[model samples]
Target: MSEKIALGNWGEELVAKKARCPKCKNAKTLKKLTQNFKCADLICDFCGFVAQVKTSSTNDINTLPNSILGAAWGPQKERMDAGIYTSLFVVLRSKSDKNYSIFFLPSELQVPEMFVAREPLSGNAKRAGWQGFLIDTTLVADRFVRLI
Candidate 1:
């Protein structure tokens, strides 16, 4: 598997093993959903809470980045337009020591300005015309809850 995929999987596993559902506070309730699930990676089996996970390797494990890359822009835009937001779990992994941290950004703390649409892919690319978004963490930096 690709390094990106492996990193993401590792982060997901850490979340599954460590973090409990914020809504229900149930242990081991977060289950990995199918990749096809739009904008969500894990779901709370007990409380039905769904969240999106973004994993990144960084040199500074103590600090959260200014922005986190998000998945498809279409669904994100649609959800924003409808006033629907998903909870975001940001997993920061250290590049040197492989240590990691988890930060939870609740849906209630999210705003429209935080979702920045990225440019579409080039026509020659495999997923040509596909677009993504970036979650501007700077906008809600103070609102994130450190889960780990």
Candidate 2:
């Protein structure tokens, strides 16, 4: 019996938040003092249901697919909790070769500028862009997994 520390610090609250919802398949955002992992403007994938997720729940976000990670899609966009679910289509430029190689981001991120693509893609080009070679993500991942 020594010290009775009053739990009043903001950082303390973040330590308490551990519960995650497996049904929704994700973890809560870092404790933002706002509590409750919510997205009031968020729309559902299975149904048209609109609601916010309580961040207090202990959800292991890594269990979900990589499609939802750090991504904001659709009209409203809203906000989302990220994990392995987030992915990005990054364009890297090689000065020596003077070519652009589109790589998946985060995991594939390297030194910036040095790893930058040849040029920024215009919206028109993005819609109908062709890098000549068509390498599918699924194919690459599957091959890698087999090698492992």
Candidate 3:
């Protein structure tokens, strides 16, 4: 098979391909999971590292320049522990009105767990104080430039 393949799901096509493992730097072990959440999950069998990509449901993608798009997380503690940061965040563009969506990628977008005070947070998330990572979009612009 080729290095990349388009997997269809829910009548939508998922562009899937192998990804590099951030932990072990293994090129072959990381592949995008086409099932489950419909986005992408970078899972590395070489080091047991896994991360998810979440697509925004909202149509209004025109966000303020260099701002956070949103936040998300897996309910399982195991996944959280495996992640570099317990919380995750997505960033917006620096300046643009176009509808550009970003994913809350792990490994690359990790934050210190302590900084996230979940106990003081209150929202729809029943998990605790704060659920997702608090990130500044400016710092992550370079990392997600391809997506932008």
TM-scores, all models, native as reference: 0.97, 0.17, 0.36
Pairwise lDDT winner, candidates 2 and 3: 3
* Runs of candidate 3 exceeding 4 Å displacement: 1-18, 37-40, 54-109, 112-136, 139-148
Per residue, candidate 3 scores C-alpha lDDT tens digits across 1-148 of 3211121221121212323455686767755555553113445667766654433333355442343322443333344466534212232222234344444444455443422323335666575564443335465545442323
- Candidate 3 global TM-score: 0.36
Structural RMSD, model 3 = 9.0
Compare candidates 2 and 3 on TM-score and give the better one: 3
As a whole number from 0 to 100, the lDDT of residue 66 in candidate 2 is 22
Off by over 4 Å in 1: none
Comparison by lDDT, 1 against 2, better one:
1
- By descending lDDT, how would the candidates be arranged? 1, 3, 2
Query: Which residue ranges in model 2 land beyond 4 Å of their true spot?
Result: 1-78, 82-86, 105-148
Q: Tell me how many clashing residue pairs each candidate has.
A: 0, 16, 5
CA lDDT of 8 in candidate 2? 21
RMSD value for candidate 1? 0.9
